[model samples]
Target: MKNVKKPIAEELDLFEKKFAENVRSRNPMLDRIMRFIIRRKGKQMRPMFVFLAAKISGTVTEATYRASSLIELLHTATLVHDDVVDDANLRRNFFSINALWKNKVAVLVGDYLLSKGLLLSLDNDDFRILKIVSTAVKEMSEGELLQMEKTRKLDIKEEVYFEIIRSKTASLLASACAAGAWSATGDEEKTRLFHSFGEKIGISFQIKDDLFDYGHDNIGKPTGIDIKEKKMTLPLIYTLQQADDSTKRRIIYIVKNHNKDKQKVNEVIELVKQSGGIAYAREKMLAYQQEAMALLHQFPESEARTAMEELVQYVTERRY
Candidate 1:
């Protein structure tokens, strides 16, 4: 991440200042919450994508900063709402908004952030970038609902898994790149290309996350949490696909009925490892990474382009 941020160091510093100003509120309570969110901010990868994509397409401008802030605002809002829905206590190792402020306040905070994002774009007449991100928010909602629907049934096929991730995880990243490119260059063609590139990278990112569920990584989440939640990931799907009928039945029964049982969840994880599910997922992840790199290569080589390439590699290589 250090290497990826090197080229955009100055831009990122300026963005942070501007983004801080953008999210400020006159209400003391809201202002305090906003400060808390900023202090506990994650890697800022989405804003990084926005700036890097802008630099690759054209020079970074004021619009690029707005694009980054808008994306972050929307992303943060969704995360706040997500914690309420998941009943999660933490985010990025910090107490979640819901955990700290209760669901009612957290939900209101999310709505506040979302409205701020919309007003920021609409007030500036950033119609093009707004359209791109709004579409992603819609897709994300659909993807999440689709995953929940599939989880209840535990019948997620390989294609359905891809669709869910593409919509849920990939759409926002895709829009970040697209919004950045459009903000900088106003070139529809380049914006579309970057959007596709981001989607491929996002898909690979999620696959790597799924693989973590079967590993002993200190990624802050427990092994087989996905299984415990009855979420069917690519590895588990592929593992079940290759199993004998009896084996399939046994695994499905465990996942559907015994998901909360530690011994049963471990058994399912072991089955995934023994059945080469990890290897299969890793292969697919690399394939998507290659595709994203290919699209990225279409742009002329530069410091920003190199940083973007390294960022792509970092997505699959990161420890957590």
Candidate 2:
């Protein structure tokens, strides 16, 4: 299963070369920025999953390449716009496109990526895939709006937070898998099942990411940015829900009213840990991952299924 890594990279490289044909000529500036991003890519997880699924299911083809690359394009677009919306200065420990290139250029490039994704999906002559991807874009937007609507509000519950992550993160992941399965055979049921698996794993991934916000030297980004941004996440929500009145008030005041401090952030995490909030989140994440794994029951035991299982586990163990 892990052996999929090398083979997947080979395919991505070939596909990317074809995908970038004329990218330099027609859109020179955009191409340069995009090329830079392509050079620094961490993982084409969405595309890799689709390719592996196709391989396991039998025969990777143009359909798999089309669907998977569309996802990569959309994910990159989302990251570009997210940096602008969050006013983030850095990403992957580098200056954000929005910060360095200016938001206007960033916005246009993000829009370009989105347009490219749709145009490429349409080129496949599959209206169904286009519809699914379009719906995913809408889902991501609505989820982000919902999260923003809840920001700085200390009373946000765990259920609501889960709902938010599902919409914002899981929906796109599910859509990617669904598109991949559909590309393979258009077996609607199988597509739906992969979608289910992706949705579960995606939500778990985001929840784990939230957990990293309270820890030191967490992954690529700085810790406690959520607190500085005044956004309440699952762990903090859980702590406030279960903590004593004094501790609850103190946590709220430190995060919401006073300036953001690392010491207070640590104390807040301690409160969440002591109140079993961390344990509860860990359980929830595992349950979601298990649900994701269970969805593979419909498929046979094969290398691809094993690859998919490993993908879910990777998200579960993410440090950031």
Best by TM-score: 1
RMSD of each: 1.5, 2.6
| lDDT on C-alpha atoms for all candidate structures | 0.94, 0.77
Give model 1's TM-score versus the native structure: 0.98
List the candidates' TM-scores in order: 0.98, 0.91
lDDT of 1 by residue, 71-189 (tens): 99999999999999999999999999999989999999999999999999999999999999999999999999999999988889999999999999999999999999999999999
Q: What local lDDT does model 2 show for residue 101?
A: 90
lDDT of 2 by residue, 134-225 (tens): 78888888988888888746667778888889889898888888887888877788777888888898889887877777662245533676
Candidate 2: regions farther than 4 A off: 1-9, 22-25, 216-222
Clashes of 2: 0
